[model samples]
Target: MVADDSKMWRTILKDLLSSEGYDVITAEDGLQAYFKIYESCVDVLISDVIMPGLNGYQLCRILKKDPHLKDMPVILLTGSADSVDRFWSMYSGADAYIEKTSSNALDNVKKILKNFKWKSDMPPQDGKNVFGAVLDELLAETTLRAEISELSNHVEDVDYTIQKIRNLLRSLFGIKAFAALMITMSEMILYSSLKDMKKTEEDLLSRLKRPYFPSYHTYRTIDGKEDVEGLNSIYKVISYDGKEEGVLALWRERSFSVREEKLLSIICEEIGGIFKNIIEVNEYRKNAYLDDLTGIANFRAIEGHLEKLWNSGKNFEISIIDIDHFKKVNDSYGHEVGNEVLAGLGKMLREFGEKHDVFVGRFGGEEFMAISEKSNFLTSVMNEFRQMVEKAHFSQSMPTLSISVSAGVARRDDFSSYTEVIEFADGLLYQAKKEGRNKVISYESIG
Candidate 1:
């Protein structure tokens, strides 16, 4: 599968892959590539990281978890040479990385395929197995190890990026403390999504309606509302083929001073490249650990994260939250609204969880989990979340709705394993529903 937002690049890539005697499938974005994987057998995925929906990293993570597709190799194309770019690409599960502008891009791709083919042709030892069995096992192991190593390295890169972004923001904004704080918060959100390591478009007229980064002044004014007015500066929105995926906004306090606009343009160019790289890395990672519909961490991924946290001996709180009467919601509102609610809840969790050291993800349909480092602070946060949901206003075309969630919280201690912790939290969640729907229950009380 070859996924990119650029028609020219897609055409060029298709031609290159076909010339090598490989079957080629093309998609304009990550979402389309995802559907293609389900519909067909894709031996390899060659994708651009940044697309409108289901960017490369997210796609990659999703693919990695599939038993059938986990062994397939992935190559990410980007225009960046930065350590952040390379690290993320590897971390996100890319087997190989190439710079789009490199003269040897095609040659490098050929080399990757050649190596893959060589491994795929390895002979089986003994008459006990089929010829393809040995090669398949070898490929799968090699790919799995590569993904683990890549994820470790990517996590380190995320740490480095957080630091670098913090410093860069401070230096550029000249508001040391404030810049550091803002950058830290921004990095937390960006890196969290990136670390989930998991990781498109419309026409020009439609594109203009999407959200964008505004000039610094405009950002300040519009911080509280959804309105974008008096935002004099230009904001760039990435369009693939013709569809809009997402927008990147750069802010200046005022119109360019000196040749600042030119400098800013250069910076934006670098950012654009970084954005592309990040998306690619994320897609590769996503192929490893995401649920296609809810866009949350799948069971495999959540278990992996839980084990890591427990083994690391970190102090944290885990909560299992489920929508009260979710089946009824689906029956009453239709599956479409149920999906919307799930997606909406995920977004809300992300937004609210930003206030603390929280990791929120959809565990499955109508069930989600939140992990936080601060046990003492959780109740207040949970209460705030409850209020937020209670007051939330949904689209009016839908039926009148008053929805609630049941939550059970558990704190990790010496005896906890990921399984025990999850089971305890889940039990508590059920208890909450038994006591009363729409209330928070703590595991300690049950113990």
Candidate 2:
């Protein structure tokens, strides 16, 4: 029996298995498949994990508990790459778990079927003993537990992090709103519940910014403002690596009891590590796509951006800019000064890209690239940037020093592929250098 929600997968699997000399029966969903399995003399069942009415796990669990069908081979298949699905399939007593996305899916299914010894003596069982209400409740509880367990492993999105934390706390305190203030080495970030609390935020920031003992505290205050007067608050200073770095605060109209305060303290004790992990993960992700020295998008990021635009069939232009006589600058001055020059140029190009509605990145050492939707004045835009680099001072110590850039611009129509466009632009850049340094070369200029 082949059970899948997608008609294409159902047709394909049925045709393949039928060609392999096994009689194939198809159902659009797990519920229909469950009824059909009881009526037909099925040797093995192949079920897709995600289906309407009943999922693969739910169906497998029901079959495994029945006296007659307990020995039947059940193969669970899914297109999902998440590891949690494998765990769930095993927990639900599936005979074998297979990913539909795998190249050897049919081979794996055939292998499992070949090794199975069918218990032909036991007849098919009826659905009279199956309790739908009990099964539904069990599945609901199991799913909720799985989602809560997954929270610790998944922390890629900021909004998801906050929402999950809120959900975790909602049962404990009937949580309405909360706020967090994180202080990293580079910047400070603040998050608050969607409820309007501008005045409350101001008060908390002013009061909590000072140094505090690394512990949770509860306070009841009667400030002049009516909103502030009736509230009770609890806040904890989160410390890691022997230094205070952040704070988490919650407040409500009713005063917090002693038991709730202790629970809050226990929960707050572990939050420091969570916030630290979030900050470190965010930093690592940011550094992965940005150039270390120049703070611009790196080559890998640039390539991804260009590929995305190209795949979308957008009309755009690519501009390649190279610093003239950059090797001489490194030889005359130390690499430290050369780095300063590169950093300054990167910053200037970033600002220029933002102002001109272009995307710019550091292609490599002494070379930067810009991408923009094709415009009639594309050549003039490149010249404007070239002139900016010519006029800018790279270092305050040597105000009289001059720096210039040579550029090449190519439109999307000039080449068949994005890589070819970049190569053509690079050739124009070489032509500019061959004719004279610090020149803007393009198809328009050469033509």
Candidate 2 lowest-lDDT run of ten: 215-224
TM-scores for every candidate against the unseen true structure: 0.44, 0.50
The digit string of per-residue lDDT tens for model 1 on 200-255 reads 11111133553333211101111122222332333444333344333434333444
User: lDDT of each model, Cα atoms only?
Assistant: 0.61, 0.76
The alpha-carbon root-mean-square deviation between model 1 and the true structure, to one decimal in Å, is: 22.1
Instruction: Tell me the tens digit of each residue's lDDT in model 2 across 1-447.
Output: 999999998998898888888889988988888777777757788999999989999888887765577888899999998999999999999989999999999888888888888844556555433446436645654554554546656556755765676666666676555676655645455566524455544555565546433221222221212333455777777666655557777767777886577556556555666677777776786698889777778999999999999999988888899999999888987788898899889888877887788888999989999988866556788899888888888976667777999989888885779999899889999999998979988867766
The residue pairs in collision within model 2 are none
Q: What lDDT is obtained when candidate 1 is compared to the true structure?
A: 0.61
Can you tell me which runs of candidate 1 are displaced by over 4 Å?
1-275, 286-296
